[model samples]
Target: MHVTAILSHADEGGFTAFNPETGTATQGETLDEALANLREAVELYLEEFPMATRAAPFVTSFDVAVHA
Candidate 1:
Protein backbone atom coordinates (compact mmCIF):
# COMPACT_ATOMS: atom_id res chain seq x y z
CA MET A 1 0.00 0.00 0.00
CA HIS A 2 1.07 3.54 -0.71
CA VAL A 3 1.06 5.83 2.33
CA THR A 4 1.74 9.55 2.73
CA ALA A 5 3.57 10.75 5.85
CA ILE A 6 4.16 14.28 7.14
CA LEU A 7 6.76 14.63 9.88
CA SER A 8 7.67 17.43 12.22
CA HIS A 9 10.03 17.68 15.18
CA ALA A 10 8.89 18.95 18.53
CA ASP A 11 10.74 21.70 20.37
CA GLU A 12 12.21 19.10 22.73
CA GLY A 13 13.11 16.87 19.72
CA GLY A 14 10.74 14.00 19.16
CA PHE A 15 8.70 12.57 16.29
CA THR A 16 5.01 12.68 15.41
CA ALA A 17 3.06 10.47 12.98
CA PHE A 18 -0.06 10.78 10.84
CA ASN A 19 -1.73 9.34 7.75
CA PRO A 20 -2.66 11.50 4.76
CA GLU A 21 -5.46 9.22 3.67
CA THR A 22 -6.92 9.70 7.13
CA GLY A 23 -5.98 13.41 7.03
CA THR A 24 -3.72 12.92 10.04
CA ALA A 25 -0.34 14.59 10.58
CA THR A 26 2.51 14.23 13.07
CA GLN A 27 6.03 15.38 13.91
CA GLY A 28 9.62 14.13 13.95
CA GLU A 29 13.15 15.45 14.21
CA THR A 30 13.74 14.55 10.56
CA LEU A 31 11.33 13.85 7.73
CA ASP A 32 13.22 10.83 6.39
CA GLU A 33 13.55 9.18 9.77
CA ALA A 34 9.99 9.98 10.70
CA LEU A 35 8.79 8.45 7.44
CA ALA A 36 10.68 5.25 8.18
CA ASN A 37 9.14 5.04 11.63
CA LEU A 38 5.73 5.76 10.18
CA ARG A 39 6.22 2.78 7.84
CA GLU A 40 6.51 0.47 10.81
CA ALA A 41 3.55 2.21 12.42
CA VAL A 42 1.32 1.53 9.43
CA GLU A 43 2.25 -2.13 9.37
CA LEU A 44 1.55 -2.42 13.07
CA TYR A 45 -1.75 -0.67 12.59
CA LEU A 46 -2.71 -3.15 9.91
CA GLU A 47 -1.74 -6.06 12.10
CA GLU A 48 -3.79 -4.70 14.95
CA PHE A 49 -6.73 -3.60 12.81
CA PRO A 50 -7.12 -6.82 10.82
CA MET A 51 -9.03 -7.22 7.54
CA ALA A 52 -10.53 -9.75 5.19
CA THR A 53 -8.31 -11.69 2.77
CA ARG A 54 -7.96 -10.24 -0.76
CA ALA A 55 -9.16 -6.93 0.65
CA ALA A 56 -6.77 -4.25 -0.43
CA PRO A 57 -5.48 -1.87 2.19
CA PHE A 58 -6.14 1.82 1.71
CA VAL A 59 -3.46 3.73 -0.17
CA THR A 60 -2.61 7.31 0.65
CA SER A 61 -0.84 9.58 -1.84
CA PHE A 62 0.01 13.18 -0.93
CA ASP A 63 1.87 16.31 -1.95
CA VAL A 64 3.38 19.02 0.24
CA ALA A 65 3.19 22.61 -0.98
CA VAL A 66 4.93 25.40 0.79
CA HIS A 67 3.98 29.02 0.29
CA ALA A 68 6.71 31.57 0.62
Candidate 2:
Protein backbone atom coordinates (compact mmCIF):
# COMPACT_ATOMS: atom_id res chain seq x y z
CA MET A 1 0.00 0.00 0.00
CA HIS A 2 1.02 3.61 -0.57
CA VAL A 3 0.34 6.88 1.20
CA THR A 4 0.55 10.61 0.50
CA ALA A 5 3.05 13.08 1.95
CA ILE A 6 3.37 16.83 2.11
CA LEU A 7 6.91 18.14 2.79
CA SER A 8 7.84 21.59 3.89
CA HIS A 9 10.97 23.33 5.13
CA ALA A 10 11.68 24.20 8.71
CA ASP A 11 12.56 27.61 10.08
CA GLU A 12 16.20 26.57 10.22
CA GLY A 13 16.39 25.15 6.70
CA GLY A 14 15.39 21.55 7.35
CA PHE A 15 12.26 19.63 6.39
CA THR A 16 8.98 18.45 7.87
CA ALA A 17 6.52 15.81 6.71
CA PHE A 18 2.74 15.57 6.72
CA ASN A 19 0.70 12.44 6.11
CA PRO A 20 -2.59 13.72 4.72
CA GLU A 21 -4.47 10.48 5.36
CA THR A 22 -3.42 10.18 9.01
CA GLY A 23 -2.70 13.87 9.75
CA THR A 24 0.77 13.04 11.11
CA ALA A 25 4.02 14.90 10.56
CA THR A 26 7.77 14.57 11.13
CA GLN A 27 10.88 16.55 10.41
CA GLY A 28 13.56 15.56 7.97
CA GLU A 29 16.27 17.23 5.83
CA THR A 30 15.28 16.97 2.17
CA LEU A 31 12.13 15.92 0.35
CA ASP A 32 13.69 12.84 -1.22
CA GLU A 33 15.32 11.95 2.06
CA ALA A 34 12.17 12.67 3.99
CA LEU A 35 10.03 10.49 1.76
CA ALA A 36 12.61 7.70 2.02
CA ASN A 37 12.63 7.90 5.79
CA LEU A 38 8.86 8.33 5.93
CA ARG A 39 8.39 5.14 3.94
CA GLU A 40 10.28 3.23 6.60
CA ALA A 41 8.50 4.99 9.40
CA VAL A 42 5.13 4.21 7.86
CA GLU A 43 6.17 0.60 7.38
CA LEU A 44 7.10 0.26 11.02
CA TYR A 45 3.88 1.97 12.01
CA LEU A 46 1.77 -0.35 9.89
CA GLU A 47 3.58 -3.36 11.30
CA GLU A 48 2.38 -2.28 14.72
CA PHE A 49 -1.04 -1.30 13.32
CA PRO A 50 -2.06 -3.07 10.19
CA MET A 51 -4.45 -1.70 7.53
CA ALA A 52 -6.55 -3.24 4.78
CA THR A 53 -5.01 -2.73 1.38
CA ARG A 54 -3.98 -5.21 -1.28
CA ALA A 55 -2.31 -3.05 -3.89
CA ALA A 56 1.09 -1.75 -4.88
CA PRO A 57 2.38 1.75 -4.25
CA PHE A 58 0.63 4.60 -6.04
CA VAL A 59 2.83 7.60 -5.44
CA THR A 60 2.37 11.07 -6.88
CA SER A 61 4.76 13.98 -6.42
CA PHE A 62 4.99 17.61 -7.54
CA ASP A 63 6.89 20.78 -6.71
CA VAL A 64 5.37 23.90 -5.26
CA ALA A 65 6.84 27.29 -4.40
CA VAL A 66 6.39 28.48 -0.84
CA HIS A 67 5.60 32.10 -0.08
CA ALA A 68 6.72 33.99 2.95
Candidate 3:
Protein backbone atom coordinates (compact mmCIF):
# COMPACT_ATOMS: atom_id res chain seq x y z
CA MET A 1 0.00 0.00 0.00
CA HIS A 2 1.13 3.52 -0.77
CA VAL A 3 1.32 6.00 2.06
CA THR A 4 2.36 9.63 2.45
CA ALA A 5 5.41 10.38 4.51
CA ILE A 6 6.15 13.84 5.92
CA LEU A 7 9.75 14.32 6.94
CA SER A 8 11.31 17.24 8.77
CA HIS A 9 14.59 18.02 10.42
CA ALA A 10 14.51 17.64 14.17
CA ASP A 11 15.43 20.61 16.34
CA GLU A 12 18.20 18.87 18.23
CA GLY A 13 19.38 16.64 15.38
CA GLY A 14 18.45 13.88 12.96
CA PHE A 15 15.16 13.63 11.05
CA THR A 16 11.55 12.95 11.93
CA ALA A 17 9.01 11.13 9.78
CA PHE A 18 5.24 10.89 10.03
CA ASN A 19 2.67 8.83 8.15
CA PRO A 20 -0.70 10.52 7.68
CA GLU A 21 -2.59 7.36 6.79
CA THR A 22 -2.12 5.66 10.13
CA GLY A 23 -0.87 8.64 12.11
CA THR A 24 2.33 6.74 12.78
CA ALA A 25 5.42 8.84 13.54
CA THR A 26 9.08 7.96 13.95
CA GLN A 27 12.53 9.50 13.96
CA GLY A 28 16.06 8.60 12.90
CA GLU A 29 19.49 10.09 12.53
CA THR A 30 19.35 10.08 8.75
CA LEU A 31 16.72 10.49 6.03
CA ASP A 32 16.96 6.84 5.02
CA GLU A 33 16.77 5.71 8.61
CA ALA A 34 13.82 7.99 9.32
CA LEU A 35 11.91 6.65 6.33
CA ALA A 36 12.77 3.09 7.29
CA ASN A 37 11.52 3.62 10.81
CA LEU A 38 8.33 5.21 9.51
CA ARG A 39 7.79 2.26 7.17
CA GLU A 40 8.23 -0.22 9.99
CA ALA A 41 5.83 1.73 12.19
CA VAL A 42 3.19 1.87 9.49
CA GLU A 43 3.56 -1.84 8.79
CA LEU A 44 3.04 -2.72 12.42
CA TYR A 45 -0.01 -0.47 12.61
CA LEU A 46 -1.51 -1.96 9.47
CA GLU A 47 -0.99 -5.54 10.70
CA GLU A 48 -3.27 -4.83 13.64
CA PHE A 49 -5.81 -2.73 11.72
CA PRO A 50 -5.79 -2.87 7.97
CA MET A 51 -7.19 -0.16 5.75
CA ALA A 52 -9.33 -0.83 2.71
CA THR A 53 -8.54 2.40 0.94
CA ARG A 54 -6.50 5.21 2.35
CA ALA A 55 -7.46 8.59 0.98
CA ALA A 56 -4.54 10.66 -0.20
CA PRO A 57 -3.90 13.60 2.02
CA PHE A 58 -3.90 17.09 0.55
CA VAL A 59 -0.83 19.02 1.54
CA THR A 60 -0.76 22.77 1.36
CA SER A 61 0.81 25.70 3.09
CA PHE A 62 -0.81 28.63 4.89
CA ASP A 63 0.81 31.72 6.26
CA VAL A 64 0.07 33.72 9.33
CA ALA A 65 0.91 37.37 9.63
CA VAL A 66 2.85 38.56 12.62
CA HIS A 67 2.80 42.12 13.95
CA ALA A 68 5.85 43.56 15.61
Q: Show where candidate 3 strays beyond 4 Å.
A: none
Model 2, range 1-68, lDDT digits (tens) per residue? 76777788889877877776555667778888877777777777778888787565566778999999
Model 1 agreement with the true structure over 16-62: per-residue lDDT tens digits: 77865444454557777677777776777777775344544556568
lDDT of 1 at 46: 70
TM-scores, each model vs. reference:
0.49, 0.65, 0.81
Best by lDDT: 3
Pitting candidate 2 against candidate 3, the one with the higher lDDT is: 3
Residue 39 of model 1 has an lDDT of: 79
TM-score, ranked from best to worst: 3, 2, 1
Ranking by lDDT: 3, 2, 1
Clash pairs, candidate 3, are: none
Q: At residue 42, what lDDT does model 2 achieve?
A: 77
Candidate 1: where are CA atoms >4 Å away? Answer: 20-28, 50-68
Which residue pairs show backbone clashes in model 2? none
Question: Considering TM-score, which of the candidate structures 2 and 3 is the better prediction for this target?
Answer: 3
